[model samples]
Target: MTKVLLAGESWMTHSIHVKGFDSFTTSAYHEGGTEMIAAMRAAGLDVTYQPAHIAADHFPLSAEALAAYDVVILSDIGANTLLMPDRTFARSEPTPNRLRLIADFVKGGGGLLMVGGYLTFQGIEGKAAYAGTPVDDVLPVALMTRDDRSERPEGVVPAIVNGAHPVMAGLTEWPTFLGYNRSMLREDATLLAEVDGDPFIAVRTVGSGRSAIFASDCGPHWGPPAFLAWPGYGPLWANLCNWLAG
Candidate 1:
């Protein structure tokens, strides 16, 4: 069975609330990959999840380590997390560049996919900072330099560019997505889907491997309940994995 590694989509958040001279602060841990994992599992694939916190310490440090999985997905996690691992940042010890390992993994025929979020692509305030990274070079599209987010609380529907594509085989017209990162497709990549002229779903063949990009969240907020509930959601991701893993 094809195995997949999913990283990110889990976070610890701290918030402050103040009203009429009353102030309070609280912290919470949240995960958004439940639906994505479910969708992949439903698609008949084996998945291993690495939350943001764990990814910092456990994300593969070398291509050989990454070889444990057939497909790797990066979602809602910043480059810094992988670049500055605990061993490197906290221990002040030199470490292998995970970003380079990921690049080599894909180039050596392993599957890769990048899902968008505030900490993905050229994220909020450009803090995600993947623009010039090795991973970015292997992506099917080019990320923007500044913040690439497109906020559409009103929802923007995706247009299927090639329903004949394997990933779009069972998918018809897709439901609306709240928002997504605006990315430009590479000349060699195939545009599978789009939203308001921005690249929403794209794919490409990199070296002996395959890669794709879903410039939108797979869960809440951008995905919302309605989008996740869409009948095509599960199959959409399943096919993506199947194709990449091939």
Candidate 2:
């Protein structure tokens, strides 16, 4: 079994209001890490999900902890969560930095996958700025801006750029993305998919490890409806996971 470590914020409260109504209410939201883990496991991979509800100043906690997984996944979380000012940004002693540790892990042969969201790769309003961090150097593509986010309607579609790659093997065409954060590709990056010429999916190899960036939300509300409802969703993510682990 391929050991995979999945990390992200699991709980969220969103403010929503009825259409054309002024009244608003708060709704709960959870990250898609668990869903992806389940899908991967169903496809025959060993997945261990480690969700961080609060930000940590130091990364990985321990080198021993970092060595336990073959792949790590970051979805829908900001940089501050992994690189807080101190071990306790609110109040605590400074300790090991998890972001730096993650970079080292990748450099030492651990695969990484970064999924898009309101808080990933210079997310909405520049909240999840990851441009200058150690994590950036390992990613396949460069972020567009620390503050810009683009949205596509329900019917908007994504085009495949590298149809022959293993990641795109079984997936010839994907359904429309309800929306995605916009990003640009590095000249050396391998473009896998695009939307209106902008890179939607990209992959690259760093050291003995592999990295992939999916510049779109993989959960409800932000991801394409077809992604969750489509029959191929499981295989699509599974293949990506396998590629990353390799």
Candidate 3:
């Protein structure tokens, strides 16, 4: 079985309410990858999740620590989480750059994937900030330095650029997405799919491993309810992970 690590896709929301003379604020936590993880497990793969809040404390800090899994996925999490851990910041203690660990892991024959979201790729306000980082050295596509999200209020559909590829096999049709991160194509990478004529999926072989970029979310607000319920959803994710593992 291929073991996988998924970091991100979890967030906290704060809400405030005021009426008459009383005021109250509330905070809630949410996770977006329920279907994604279910799909992977349905395909018989062992998977683990490290939500955004605890990523810095729980994410593997070295290539050896990361070696426990065959694939590492970064979705909707900023690079700073792994770059500047609590100890490194609050205590001024020297710490390793987990992003660099991921880069090295891929080069050493480990698979890696980066899914898109508000805090992924260049992300909202470009604060996700993976563009010039060590992780960029291993991604199959190039990230924009500025904000990269392309919000499609009306929704857009994805087109298969390489239907015969295993990643696209069993994917007869794709669901419409509400948004995605725009990425530049790499000359050495194989483009698998596109959305609104932008690179949607790209794959490449690293030193002794494989790497992939999926420029859209596996769940909402980019992936609407219909998309999450689409018949091809689970199979598509399973195939992507399996192919990378192989």
Candidate 4:
């Protein structure tokens, strides 16, 4: 059984009765982290889910407590949630950062997978800016900016780049994704899948550990239902977990 740690915002309350386009009360939508955990567990992997409800003050503590899992999944959360007041750009020179700690964890042999959302990788309006952070160095691809998100109303078609990679083994084409965070890739990165000439899925090796970045959301509202209903979902995520653990 592979032990995995998942962290991200869980408690979200939307404001109600906002005038025109935004007329509704505080409602909670299912998050991606929980969805991934369920998929992993259904594949027989032992998963430990740690959701950061009020993330603004809980991420640093959660990052520091990630030693127990074989892999870590960061979904729908951004940089500001992990930055302590003292570590903000206004106060320090960006030394001894939490992002660095995550990089070090991977370098010291930890697996990591980052999923996309409105708050991931230079997210909408530059929310979860990860370009210059230590997390960027460990990723197989390059993140351009958070505001560069791509919305595919007709959804995207994914094509496998390396069918032989362990993470991709036993899998064919994946289901269409509704949207994704746009990102550039480093020369050393391996492109796994693409959509309209853009890289949709990618992976890279960092020291003894490995990391993968799926630029699309794995949750229901963002990804196709086939991702969870199809037979391939189990093996797809299983392969990812096994590769990351190695």
Candidate 5:
């Protein structure tokens, strides 16, 4: 089985509840990668999901630790989470740069995939902030310095530019996505699919490894219920994971 380590796609929200007389705060947690994870596992891939907070402290900081998986996925997570662990952030202790470790892992023959979301690639208000990081350097597309999300509440259709690519295998039709990140395709990268003429799915070979980017969320918001219900949904993710593991 292809071993995959998926990080991010989870978040906590705190809201203030005000009733004319008083106000109280409430907090809730949510995850967005449930469907995607199930799909990969159903396809026989060994998947380990690390929510944003958990990943912030536990994501591999060494190449040897990362080597345990064939593919590493970053989805809906910002750079700061991985860049600053408890030791580094609270104790002011030096730690290995996790972003560089991921980049090096890919170059050493591991696969890397980044799934888009509100906190993925130069996300909302540019809070994701992955523009010039080492992770950005190995991606098949170039991220924008500012907020890159192109909100399409009206929805947009994705066009498969390279349907023949293995990553798109068994995928014929696609459901509309609410929105996606807009990115520039690299010269050597393969544009497998696109939305609004911008890269939606792209891949590239980096040294002895491979990397791919899905400019839209894998589950909600961008990937609406209609998309998650699409028959090809499972196969699409399965294909991407398998192709990357290759």
Candidate 6:
């Protein structure tokens, strides 16, 4: 089985409510990758998911730790989470730069896949801010320096441009997506699908490893329920993981 470590795709929300002259605060935690993880696991891949808060402290800190998994996936998580762990942010202690570690891991023949969201690739208001990081160099696309989201409420359907690629195997028709992160395809990368004149799915070989980008969320609000229910969903993810693991 392909060993995969997926970081992010979970968030916590805090809200205040007012009724009459009283106010109350509420907090909730949510995961957006439940279906995606199940789909990958059903395909026989061993997936270890680390939500945003957990990943801030628990994401791999060394090449040896990263080597335990064939692929590392970053989705809906900002660079700061991995960059400033507790030791570095709170204790004023020097810590391993996880972004650089991931970059080296890819160069050392590991696989990397970045799925887009509000906090993935140069996200909303540029808060995701992955443009100039070490991990940016390892991605198949060049991220913008500012906010890169393309809102397509009218529904944008991705078109297959590289049907022959292994990642597209058994995937013929694709459902519409609500939005996606816009990125420039790197010169050395292969584009598998495209939407709104941007690279929707792109892949590249980095040193002895491989890297790919899925320019949208694995679930809503960028990925709609229709897409999650699409018959090709499971096969698409499986094929991509297998191709990357190889």
Q: Which parts of model 4 are misplaced by more than 4 Å? A: 9-11, 18-30, 54-64, 85-96
lDDT of 1 by residue, 110-136 (tens): 999999899998889999999999999
How do the predictions measure up, each by TM-score? 0.97, 0.87, 0.97, 0.85, 0.98, 0.98
**lDDT winner among the candidates?**
6
lDDT on C-alpha atoms for all candidate structures = 0.91, 0.76, 0.90, 0.74, 0.93, 0.94
Clashing pairs in 1: none
Clashing pairs in 6: none
Task: Report the Cα lDDT for candidate 6.
Answer: 0.94
Give the residue spans of candidate 3 off by over 4 A.
none
In terms of lDDT, model 5 sits at 0.93
Where model 1 places Cα greater than 4 Å from the true spot, the runs are 19-21
TM-score preference between candidates 2 and 5, better one: 5
Clashing pairs in 3: none
Clash count per candidate: 0, 5, 0, 4, 0, 0
Instruction: Output the TM-score of candidate 2.
Output: 0.87
Model 1, C-alpha of 228: deviation from truth (Å): 1.0
Candidate 2, residue 230: how far the Cα is off, in Å: 1.8
TM-score of 6: 0.98
Worst 10 residues of 6 by lDDT: 236-245
Better of 3 and 4 by lDDT: 3
Model 2 spans with C-alpha error above 4 angstroms: 14-29, 54-59
